[model samples]
Target chain A: EPEVTQTPSHQVTQMGQEVILRCVPISNHLYFYWYRQILGQKVEFLVSFYNNEISEKSEIFDDQFSVERPDGSNFTLKIRSTKLEDSAMYFCASTGTDQETQYFGPGTRLLVL
Target chain B: QKEVEQDPGPLSVPEGAIVSLNCTYSNSAFQYFMWYRQYSRKGPELLMYTYSSGNKEDGRFTAQVDKSSKYISLFIRDSQPSDSATYLCAMGGSSGNQFYFGTGTSLTVIP
Candidate 1:
């Protein structure tokens, strides 16, 4: 089955540095999303992208976070400046249609020290 | 109150046991319910999906949704050691694409 795939399975970055987590959602998917889970915490929604624009973003998706579908298959989340609390597993998901079940990628584990 | 609530269980069971996992939500608008399985340090894998208040079964797994009570459940039958994982409940509505997730229940099935 086709699945969402993410690059840089694990990343270590210094606080105040920048990091870009990349995902290649299923080719035919129209909606893409980013979510994060802190260690021992629930997954938190970050943002959703459709039509190459952000559809909705949560409060945690503040100034430092941005998402881009620079190409047809690539969806990326960039943290302009990382913080220690930013350490978590970032996941990318996609659904083929509105209200369809989303399929998730293996995730990119981000650790900022 | 949290949008979703799930018991963070470290529940242990013997192989062949039936495991029931559940979640409750405060949002009445939620129309889409899903159950995901996650191994430690990995992303969630979709296990079940339900559109509204109903029951859906896939192979040995069954999913139940009670929208009136705002509750959902995932049942695993004849569990195996490979079934050991953290199960998360997620839901969303037509209003937007964002989903609310539970803290996840950890289960261990011993063979």
Candidate 2:
């Protein structure tokens, strides 16, 4: 079955540096999302993208966070500046249609020191 | 209060036993309920999807949602050791694409 795939399975960055997490959602999917889970915490929604624009975003998706579908197949999340509290596992998900099941990627484990 | 609440159990059950996992949410607008399974060091895998307050069964797994009570459950019958994983409950609505998740319940099905 086709699945969402993310690049840089693991990343280590210094505090105040920038990081970009990339994902290639299923080719036919129309809706894309980004979520994060802090260690020992629940998964938190970050943002949702559709039609090459953001449909929704959470409070955690503040000034430092931005998402771009620079190409037809690539969805990228960029953190302009990483903070220590930003360490977490980021997952990318996609759904083929509205109100459909969202499939998740293996996730990118980000560590900011 | 948290929007979604789960037991966060590191529960252990013998193989062939029944497993019950549950979650509660504060939002009443949530119409799409789903269960996701995550193994150690892996992302969540979709297990069950329920559109409204009803019961849905697939193989050894059953998903139940009670919109009136704002509760949902996932039951695994005749559980196997391979069923060990953390189960998360997710909720979404039609108004937007945003989704919410509960703290996962970790289960260990031992042989």
Candidate 3:
């Protein structure tokens, strides 16, 4: 079965440096999303993307965060400047038109030191 | 208050025991409910999906939703050691693709 895939399973970056996390959602899916989980915390929604534009975003998605569907298959999340609190496991998810179920990738663990 | 709430349990059970996981939500607009399983340091994997209020069973797992009470549950029958993981409950409204997730419950099935 097809599944969402993400690159750079693990990343370590210096504080204030930029980091771009990449994801390739299922080919036929129309909606994509990003979520993050801090250690010992619940999964938090970041943003949702559809039709090349942001459909919805949570307060956690602030000025430093941006998402792009640069190509038909690639969806990227860029953090302009990372903070120590930014360290967390970032997950990418996608769903078909039904929009009921979301498939998630293995996740990229980001560490901003 | 948080949109969704769950007891973060480090519940341990013997192999072959049944496991029950649950979540409650404050949002009445949520129509889609899901349960996901995640191993340590890994992303969540979809386990069960239900719409509105009802019950759904797949393999040895069962999911129950009570929209009136704003509660949901996932039950694992004849659990095994492989069932050890954190279970998260997620719900979304019909308006968009955004989903609200529970804090997750950790379970350990010792063989």
The model with the greatest lDDT is: 3
The C-alpha local distance difference test score for the whole of candidate 1 amounts to: 0.95
Model 3 chain A, poorest ten-residue lDDT window? Answer: A95-104
Tell me the tens digit of each residue's lDDT in model 1 across B1-111: 999999999999999999999999999999999999999998899999999899999999999999999999999999999999999999999754999999999999999
In model 2, which residue pairs have backbone atoms overlapping below 3 Å? none
* lDDT by residue for model 2 (A32-51), tens: 99999999999999999999
Give one digit per residue, the lDDT tens place, for model 3 in A17-89.
Answer: 9999999999999999999999999999999999999999999999999999999999999999999999999
Top candidate by DockQ: 3
TM-score of chain A of each: 0.98, 0.98, 0.99
User: Which 10 successive residues of model 3 chain B have the least lDDT summed?
Assistant: B94-103
- Interface RMS deviation of candidate 3: 0.8
- Candidate 2 regions exceeding 4 Å error are none
TM-score of each: 0.98, 0.98, 0.99
Ordered list by DockQ, greatest first: 3, 1, 2
Candidate 1, DockQ score (0 to 1): 0.81
Better of 1 and 3 by lDDT: 3
- Per-residue lDDT for B28-95 in model 3, tens only? 99999999999999989999999999999999999999999999999999999999999999999996
State the number of backbone clashes in model 2.
0
Candidate 1 on A1-113: residue-level lDDT in tens? 99999999999999999999999999999999999999999999999999889999999999999999998889999999999999999999999876458899999999999
Clashing pairs in 1: none
Please rank every candidate by TM-score, starting with the best.
3, 1, 2
